[model samples]
Target: MDTWLKESRKRADSAHHVVPIRSGVLWSEALMRQSMPPSTADPDTSRPNRIPPDVPRNMHDSYCELLLPFASSPELLEQYINASGGIRTGMLMEHLDSLAGGIAYKHMLGPGVEVLSKDQGFYMVTASVDRLDMLAPLYPVRDMRLSGQVIHTGRSSMEVAVRMEALEKDGREQTIMLGRFFMVCRDAKTHKAAPVNPLKLSTPEDKQLFALGETHKDRRRLRTSVSLDRLPPTSLEAEELHSLFLHVHQKVFGGYLMRLAYELGFANAELFTGCHVLFVSLDCISFAKPVPIGSILRLSSHILHTTSSEQFPGLIHVGVQANVVDVATGKEQTTNDFRFTWCTDHNIPLTRKVVPKTYKGPCGERLGFSEELLQRTLTSKTY
Candidate 1:
């Protein structure tokens, strides 16, 4: 294992000059400037080879940019309420890290191998995979090679670079996302610290990707802290509103605010279960404050926008706020705020539901209290 590690490191260091071009660009244009293919120099080569034609580049750059705050789709918010699952931010982090690990193993490890062990770390508030998965299916564990560079190495942790891409129908590939993670390995059962295998980075391209991943780590941190202070309002019945209050925290566990957001849609129409949550992607989540275990919380939500796709018939955005008042002392405090995305598919189409044209607070007509109350709704994506 030690000898293989040393040799692999040497090879990786030597390969540093071969940089990978960004996906979704004109590959022929870029490769044309480089040396001939290795196959051309082999004496046994018989068939003629040709460079593939260039492809048009029409891509959404949003996938490439990292670290911007995200908002949940309306469908996701509603699902939160309907399913009563409580998805947390930490779970989301786990999912992201797991996906990253899968990508690294699939791309780096040779055949006939399984991941024997894996470890991760975090630096500058961003996490990364440090130790490679040991047990691989196709390749000997000691013969495996990784291509990314270390951007930051700490006393007990390090951050390495990574990126994702998808091939388009037009024979073009697009750069999806780039970021870094921290990693540290330990004994699986005892949970004691372990040493990292010596790794040698070879290529400049690998170093560049690793560096980009580190930079994106900061951007992702920033995006996760957005505020939602600009959502509109909808009306609800007293009974339905009370039910919503009971499950504000419960629905958040599902990771999409849209589950709860769709419930608000039903309340707005004075109808029960009129809307359904279909698809949801977390845009942002923030636990600005916590809700007490037992409290009668006032909950409210509003629609952001709606569109239709072939899979889902309706799409919408809903924002929610939770507030509680102490009955004994008459003291009240805002507890939680969130935003969500919602969508639904039902046999019946939704009729235009009438929403209250004007909002009035608990007290009648003395001041523009209703508008103030509505404005208090948490609409920011930061969490």
Candidate 2:
């Protein structure tokens, strides 16, 4: 793990890179306030225990930890493969998204609190994936553990951290993937943003995680400014790219976009790492503009950085950007920015390193900004 950290840092600092900043934009307070309409003026006195403002500060109220022990069965992998024989990252992402939603639901509850359907109900949806660090590759027969917890909260948003761990046959465990998911609460009926119960910070670690969540929010504001507009890259480094174009006739889901980006990223990985690459992590993923029906969605993906190791060969980091294009005006609106990390399947030994070229032009600019964002969120030497 220490060696992997050193190698990643070395690649990041290598001269093969050139990378951006824009003035940060603040979230609309008024919009947030309006999204959360006050509940009934005259509450039902019969159910006084429901949705109270004051809740106890207990671990049960603010934290959710799940442990699932299993292996990525051959059948599971077979069900999620791309044309290149690599597993589709979308399958894993969808699972994690569901898990994050469960954590948020648990954290938002008061002790023994349950709401009847007639009463106000809160639902959660993934707003963004702040950070994902893939520490190692996953394959069949590898024992695994998946866990999630709510680290912080805003008026209507919850910051949750989830991890995937690989347990060795010798009774040792190592984290293979770590991620931060931002979830937003919404009214079940109105389907609009709604207030959620605040998180109760107790342990020192909880406080620390909460502070980290705050920092991510700050960085996201800066990222949003630069992601407002995007142009096709002119750099020769972008020549070996992978792309996907979709025409939406109905409101598109964020997961669909994530899946497309994952496909393109994995495709880019294959250009150098071969057909056996496995997903690592996704960093600084922000869904900038929601795509309605009748929009043209384009995704362009390229390798950003890479390194090789005797123990784990052909590690590649990929960056992806999505745009919504106007077919008539030929204008494009940048929709999302994502950084994905993957490695060659352990079963396959890499005789050579997959080193990506130094990025230039628009691609370089985006890569530089992504690298900066990655440094801020990554604190551990290894996943």
Candidate 3:
């Protein structure tokens, strides 16, 4: 595990040199000649074959694995999580995004792909986290092992599967989290969606994963078409979300948005279930648009359903909607759709149920579709 971590970090460091060409002019021969002294007109900076030779031009080539040992946190976080003894969900998300990006970079760094070209470089952003199923809880004392791989690729999008595992003291590894991220590749120069290499399936596993990706994409489109967050919230649920709005005056961070969404969902879960809960999973999350700085962001968390499991008897599903409010115009635009599940604290059984109020108007219909989407996600079988 330690060796894998070292090698992964080494490759990540090497890949850093490829991102600077995003300007589509920085790596130009003419620019390099003009910028460098006569003694060093062109340096052999392109270190080819840095990534593993076996990992090239296929779903197998995009594999990335890492092992990390948790260290003592700083005073602030240490004090905050000391009692709980686990890393924050936000921290986990940051690692997931980073690993997925590394895998995507490897997928785009194969034969016939320009590794360092000013005219072309595949730049990808996390389009959505389609599904994140928490298999178990993670604590700070346990070492973390992460595996990320490209499962499928489309014209300009790639689906990366990332699984989180916790290493137990006795050399046993347990799956703690599983997530699929949809990343869209864009031209570094034009900042427009760009073409990506298609997935070449050579094995049965490859075919299965590819089929799963296709299914997920179709479900995402269907759910997005009838997204309730696209419409304004009904008056009943507005009161709960009113105080959850955060006035963002600075640039929005993806990890920050994820954390906010989780907090809102968990809060609503606690409210409806009347039980202290911990975040278990997030599903069907979509980032509708880039959130600009100074946008008034609101997270509306609605209780969709509650179910019991063998390990955790009381589990609550909360549907959260992220909206950007235009205070000047008194209008709001839907930005994200998130479904979060929380496990009740102390394994308490939840006897209360949160039955959503009926929506009879157009907004109500939108919310109705939203409930159906949540139900579908809850019942759907995922790869």
Candidate 4:
């Protein structure tokens, strides 16, 4: 971990290669990257590069930590302070995204490498985030610690687990949030899939974590096989939705533990609607395709599954699927799916059970087989 800390310091003190931030030309820059002939502008994705025989790394090799001294630095706390005096969770979430990426690079390259330029042989992109659930509510004016490591690896992708902790009043590290991100490697030049260093199961705990990562990957493939765009909703599911509609006589419904940061609610939007809800954990997030410049996106969200623990009213499982449509040809593609969990107020008995009123519109089988994963996430890294 000391070595990991040194890498973090080196990242901040970059002595080589820096690009000046340009003001307001990102739209043009994106256009330049995708511009091409009529038949190739949105050409089918190129073939992914083959996996390379990279050496496997011990689970600890990619471990790293970062700290934000909100307790000691009034000025820093002021920057993250919300209008209502609560700390800004969004700003810290953005930091998590960067930290997860940096950790992925550390897993593939050595922990000492700071700069992430194309010349490093491979580039990494966050393919998806399985979940990032808030274990507990945030406290004001406290220091924050974020740590992560690559828990699982595939032929071309890695599953990275990250946790955010706070120093509690009793001087203990209490986890406030837990998250998992799936990152894939691409050949710097070929831009296809590339092999990542595998995980070395040096201990029983390491083997268990690796197994969970493997389960996560298998769950994703299963979800994809049942995606709404590719196949019709299961007959039984449709029947259930129809029965609910007949009994209620009207209505419909509407979404992540973020792959990026939206684990159990709307993407840290301007309005915080889940006032009575406490975030629990996220199940999974899937990115099916990329949205092009002129494409229009339609998002649909639903509480896919729910359960009551001994405490809260219920642990609500939810999902949001985003689809993109092409104006010229009216072609649509599934872009993303997100699964999240949160505990609502037990005072409201009605909130305990959320029944669907319509037949399935998007896929609804996301968290059906994720109970073990969810429980492990809730209890795994306790202090």
Candidate number of the best lDDT: 3
lDDT of 3 by residue, 73-139 (tens): 3553463352346567756776677677667776777523333432223366777787777766666
lDDT of 4 by residue, 1-383 (tens): 22232233343323311211112335554466445653453333332232344777777667767778888889888887766567656566667766787788777765555444323556666666666767777876678888777778999889877778898657887678877788877765566667888877776567777878888788787766655445766989666433321211011101112333343243321122244555566555655554544547666666655565455545566666677777788887776676655565443332334566554423355435455655644453321
True-structure lDDT of candidate 1: 0.33
List the candidates ranked by TM-score, beginning with the highest. 3, 4, 2, 1
lDDT tens digits by residue: candidate 1, 1-383? 22222222343323221222112324454345235564453333232221121211111000111121122234443322223243222223333344333322222221112331212221111121221211111211111112233343333334444332333335453333232345433332343443332223344544443354455455444333221122322345434332332322112222222234335543443232265443232232333333544566666765533444454445444445556678898777654444444445352344543244444311123322223222222221111
Model 4 scores worst on lDDT over the 10 consecutive residues at 247-256
- In model 1, the runs with Cα more than 4 Å from the true position are 1-275, 291-298, 309-312, 328-331, 346-350, 353-383
Supply candidate 4's per-residue lDDT for 300.
Answer: 61
Model 2 misplaced regions, further than 4 Å: 1-50, 53-77, 81-87, 110-123, 167-172, 186-193, 218-251, 272-278, 292-296, 304-315, 324-333, 343-383
Per-residue lDDT over 117-232 for candidate 2, one digit per residue giving the tens place of the 0 to 100 score: 22335556677887776665554355556656666677878777776677777888676677778887776556556776675655555555667778878766565545434544
| Local lDDT at 107 for model 1 | 23
Better TM-score candidate (1, 2):
2
Give the C-alpha lDDT of model 4: 0.59
- Distance from true location, Cα of 227 in model 4, Å: 5.5
State, as a TM-score between 0 and 1, how close model 1 is to the true structure: 0.30
Error of 1 at 1 (Å): 30
TM-score of each: 0.30, 0.61, 0.68, 0.65
Stretches off by above 4 angstroms in model 4 are 1-53, 78-91, 169-171, 221-275, 292-307, 325-332, 345-348, 351-353, 357-383
**Model 2: clashing residue pairs?**
19-368
